[model samples]
Structures are given as structure tokens and as C-alpha cells.
Target: VREEAISRSRCFLNSAMAFTLYTYPNNYRAIKSLIAAEYTGLEIVVPDEFKFPGDVRSEAFKAKSPVQKVPVLETPDGCLFESNAILRHVARYRPEANLYGGPFYEQGLVDQWLDFSAFELEPPRNVWLYPILGYMKYDKRAAGKARNDVEKALTVLEDHLLLRTFIVGERITLADIALGSALIAPFEKVFDAKFREKFTNVTRWFTTLINQPEWKAIVPSVSLCEKEQIPAFPKKKEKQPKQQKQKQQKSQAKKADDESAPPPKKKEKNPLDLLPKSEMDLDTTKRTFSNNPFPAALKIFYDAWDPEGFCLYTSSYNYNSENTVDYQTSNLVSGWLQRLDSLRKYAFGCVNVWGVEDSKGPFVINAAWVFRGPSVPFEFTDCPDSEYHQLASVDLKDEAQKAKFEALLGGAEKYDGQPLYERKQFK
Candidate 1:
């Protein structure tokens, strides 16, 4: 009797409380609320004639959103701003959907992931995507950083999804919807084949979620990224006379090209090849490190070490407080190592994470590196995680610093009083 009463009440609410989602068409953030409505069987009226900047900028719409952003949900009693908030509101109209989850604890977990999506994923996602979509001016440096951040955020998700189908419990929750919508633009626009391959679990989970009947009703279609789209500058309008002249010049250039083949381009040599040969045999040392015990490897490294030709350095992650899971922390170090593949011949090191997952962590990541040149190589410094690293030159003369180097490289049981979680080598 209670179940039937609840169903009838839901039907009444669905028929009575129609919402107006005021937003421009095809906004990814707005899609979250719409998807939630689909699950809850709520009638959300999206104004077809809604003018984007024009309508949203009006004084009438001001009450709906303070910043006059699209995706403001107008309820019977009041208005709600912020896409995530609107999503939660729509999810509440029907209690049977389990969009926010059934249990109180499950609902709290949903909120946790929603916050994660908003903070960790959305900001960097916007920074990386908006420029490509022509919503914002392109900054190469900023875009690069944003791309790295997105990958790191995805790495966290990738690790989390490895053991489960959904983010929260058995069923799809608001957390999945929030994070999934956040990822849509990225997956379709920037996450290319090679990049997507690294996060198989994330890819599988995302593919499953977006293809659902509810999600498809809102999104319509999604195409996974094939080629990465680089930030492009809009072409300036050319004068008619200039265009005609350019066509003639292009004809002449083409004729010239047909007349003769261009000379073959020369391959550029690596900068490291120009350096003076050093006595340190990196290959042998790497082999020693692999084949022998830590003590023997350290002895071999010390014997062959050339301070003038080679440089030793230490790098520690600046944001260790954000690392909560074991595999996630390990994945972070793994990603850094993968990005440094071009420097494999010129560099070697072991990166260690301290502390266990979930208990006393957020983990600590620190590493020691030996570079071919007297200074740190640009290749190592240009990796995705480089900005987060606190890099320093390791002075072997200092007994303490030398001990620290050995400890990191040898994968000591503990680092700075914390237990060593794992060590990943970049040989």
C-alpha cells in the first residue's frame, strides 16, 4: 500500500511540477540536469527560443542566476543556479530513481564525487576545452597545464573504476552523471585513441554510461576522439584584391613545385649527442640496477659516476595532500615516468610514494634522477607533472643528501618516517 501511494505521489509531482531549464542548446553542464530529469520522469521545459547571451543577460533572468549563467532551473517556489545544484534538485522530485542513491551514506558518497567532479575535473576541463571550441582565447602554456590536470583527474577516476562498474554503489548515481557529463566534451574533443588506451576501466565505464537510454535521450550522440584537436587561431578576413593576388601566387608556387622536387629535409640530431663523452655507462648501470641488489647497484653507480658530465637531482610532488588512494598515487608516478619516455637514454631514477591508501594517506611522492648533462634535461622538465614537482639539485658531497638519494633509488622500507608504498623506476 505504501509503495503504491509513493508511486501515485510521484506521478502527481511529475505532472504538477514542471521546471524551466533556461539555457542555450547543447550546453554539456545543462545536460546533467536533463539526464537526471529523464531518470526521475520529470517534465523539464527547455525554452526553444532561448537566446543565449541576450536572454541570459536580461534583468528578468537576473533572479534565476546571480551571474546570469545559463542552466538556471526555475521551480514553482524559487529558482536555482549552478548546474550541479540544479541536477540535485531535479533528482529529488522522484525518490524511486535512486539517482542520488537510496541510503543516506550512499547519498553522501554521491556528494563527495560531485564535489570531486566540480573541483578536480571541471576547472581544468574548461580551460583545456573552451579554447579549442573558440569560447576562450588560446594560451599554449595554460592549455598544456590544463591537459595534464585533466589526465591526472582521469587517472584518479581510472583507478577508482577498476574495481566497480559505477562510481558509488551498484546502480548509477548522481556522481556518475556529474563526472560523466564533465568528461563528455573531453572524450569527444581531446581524449584521442592513444590517450584513452591508458585508462581502459574509465573508458569502459564511460562508454557504458553515455550509451544508456536516459543519457542518449539528452546527449543524442557521442563520437570518441580520433585525432587530437590542437588549439587553432581563427583566420583573419582577407581583402578581395589580396585573395585574388594570393590565388595567382599560389598558382605560380604550384607550377614551380611541379617543375622540381624539393630537397630532402635533414634530420636534426639530439642536443645530448653534441656533449663530450663521459665514462659513466648508463646502459651498464641500468643493467646493474636491474640484475644486482640495491647495495651492489649503488656501488656500481658511485664508481662510474661523473659529476661534471652527469647531474643528480631530486623531485617531489607539491600536491601530495590530494592523493587518497594507493593505485591512484601509484598511477600518478607511473604517468610521470611514461611522459619521460623520450628521456629514457638520457635519464634514470626511482620515484617512491610514501604512506598507505585511505588510512594515513594522501601519499607523498618523491624521486631522484640522474641526467646525462650537468643540468636537468628539458625533456624531464617538460613532462606533464613537471609543474607540480619541487625540483632540486642533489649534492652528493653532503652525506645526508647522498643517503637520501640512496634511500630513494634503493627503495628503502621507509621515507621521512612514513612507510614506502611503492617505487617506480624510469630506467
Candidate 2:
């Protein structure tokens, strides 16, 4: 008995204190501990002792975790279950590294974000994900609610990360590792290209975490979700009895008759299709802008210009109306532009600012715009009107139009007698 006890002790402490992690392979929650182990430089051996045919409820496995849950970690001291608990244990072992943080307050922040990730992020993500994978029955309302919850959480997270590189401090921490692991399933399954684009800050934070050596050991590569998953619904049951079928058919027919039939389709619903047919060579003009020299762009603009179908205009932000902090007001313009991005296919603008902060009588903001319609598209005008703006239409056929156009195109150093401070293009 003495020899056997010494042998077990030897097995537990080979090289660097061998710890065993019990989890089903490729489990996301299990990844938390794997990453923590990597960061703490601890060896955590994943057990293959229980295979599919073998039972997880076997006496040996159950002895470690009463619930037969995966990701139970066995240290020489004792068995640690729960992924988050295991992460805390591993990180605290290397407390001098400050994985959990020091100074009391920093550790509290890590704990708060860890809990936020679990409650706010993980559950809703599962609701949105598992149903699509056929792991749970798909309910449209439930999926929508789950998606809304996730977007809400992500929006809050985006704001937190907008000014910082990492979640807590300058570098990686338990907050990031726990949240990164929690997000992996959704990143791989539902956060497709379009969805990811909406939360640029979150994408930046996630990409940074996964590229580190600690994360790469477990998740070597992650493909941003490209295709949205469709629910795998069970087929309708067939082979109904004739009397029962007739009853169901009668019910459906009566319901259909009661419902109003949809109106018949007409022409397609593209806004560009609404224009009176034109013989203008617009496509060649656009192609020139894309594929040809600068001179060709000028030629196309001059030769193919259609005054009846398109309009030229200039506008400036009501700069004097703003509180006058440079970066804040600049962000206002950027946010407005983001809101206006949907109109990109129909609009182009050269928006410029002049003078330094509080310099030369409240820096002027001017935009030279070319829009596709006679009047400004509703999309541009739909935004709340600001009294600070000065808007005017420019007729290209006017005698001085060429000079005005040239000045705007060059992003003029002086527009209306003010020196240029900055110029941003909307193309």
C-alpha cells in the first residue's frame, strides 16, 4: 500500500505537477481552462479515459465531479469543477503575474466582466446558436429576442473597448480570456461578416486576443462566420387519414379565404429603376472614375453631365452651433456620415473644415456634394435640419462653375476666405 501511494504521488507531480482536465473534446467552456493553463504555464492533460462507449457516469469519473460535467480539473490538492472556478484557480496560482489583477479594485473589475460575459453574453448566444444547430427546437421569436440581447450586450462592450486595446488594462487579463472563450462559439457559428462589421471595436478586441500565443494553442485559427445558418426543421408529417385530412384541408381553405390576398406584383422595386428612361452614358462615366486616369474622370464628369437627372450642391456643418470641442464635433460628423453611408451609391461629397479650434471665428465646415437626383434624395434631407448649415445648389453650366468645381475637387486651402484645417471625402 505504501509503494502504491508513492507511485500515485509520482504520477501527479511528473515534470511540472500534472493536472488532468476532463471535458468533451472541442468544448467551448473547456477552452477557458486550456487558455488559463497556457497563460499560467501549467500543464493540464485532457483525459481520454472516458470514450463514447464508456460511460461518463462511471465510478472513476463521477468520483471527480458529481454531476458528470466536463471541464473538471484534478490538481494534487483536490478536484476543481466549473470552468470559471477552474480559471480562477489556475490564474491565482500565478498571482504574481497579476492575471487576476492586484490592488483589489482591478481584481474586482475582472470578476465583474467575467460574470457579465457569462450572464449577458453566453446565454443569449446559446439561444441564438443552439437552435440553429438543431441542438434545440427553433422558435423565431426566441431567436429574435436572443439576437437582440446579444446585440445589446455587444453594443455596451463596444463602447467599453472603443478607447482601450484590452478589456481591463493595456494587456491580456482573465476578463479577456474568459470573455474570449465565451464568444468563440458565436464567432465560429453566428457572428458572420455583416454582423461583425457592425461592431468594429468588438472585432478588434477579439482578433487581438485570439492571435496571442495563449489562445493559438487551443484555437489555432478562427474563420469569421461567412454564411448564416438556417434552422434544420423537421419535415411535415404525411400519411394522414382521409377524414382527418379533409377536416384539416377545410380549416386551412376557410382560413385562406378569410385572409386578404396580396396585391399583384408590378415592376421591380429598385430606386434606380424609378427614373424616366435615359440615354445618358452614366455607366461609362462611373467606370472611368474606377478604371481610368484622373483626366478621364474629368472628361466623363464634363461630357456626360446630366443637369435634369443629377444635381451639384455644397453644405457646411453648423459649426458655430456646436459646443466647439474639435474631436467631439469631428465624431459627430463621422457618426452622421455612417448614418448616411446607405446613400453612397447615389452621392459623393468633399466635406472640409477650416482654421484651428476657436480660431478665425469658429472653424467653418463646408461640403461640396454631387447627388444623383434633381432634389436632394430623401435620405440626405431626412436627417434633422440644423440651422448652422449653409446649403446652395451649383449649376455646372454657369460661367464660373469650372473654377468653383476645380477648387472643391482640390479640397481648396481657402473656401469662402478661410484657411483649411482638414478635409474628409465621402465617396
| Candidate with best lDDT | 1
Model 1, position 341: C-alpha lDDT score: 88
Clashes of each: 0, 1
lDDT of 1 by residue, 1-427 (tens): 5346446755876778678889887787898889888787777899888898777657788767765666889999899987888998888877677888878999999999998997678767887888788765566666787788788989999999999999999989899999998889889988999999999999999999998998999987899999988778779987579779999999999998888877789998888878998898887878889899898888888988898789998888866755655655665677677777889989888889999654537689998888898898888878755766878888988988888888888648898788888887889
How does residue 76 of candidate 1 score in lDDT?
91
Q: Which candidate gets the maximum TM-score versus the true structure?
A: 1
lDDT of 2 at 419: 75
- In the predicted model 2, the residue pairs found to clash are 318-388
Q: How well does candidate 1 match the true structure, expressed as C-alpha RMSD?
A: 14.8
Off by over 4 Å in 1: 1-10, 234-427
| Model 2 residue-pair collision total | 1
Scored against the true structure, residue 92 in model 2 reaches a CA lDDT of 77
TM-score between model 1 and native: 0.55
Per-residue lDDT of candidate 2, residues 128-189 (tens digit): 88777655556576678779989998999999999999888776789999888888878887
For model 2, state the Cα shift of residue 264 in Å.
52
User: TM-score for all predictions?
Assistant: 0.55, 0.52
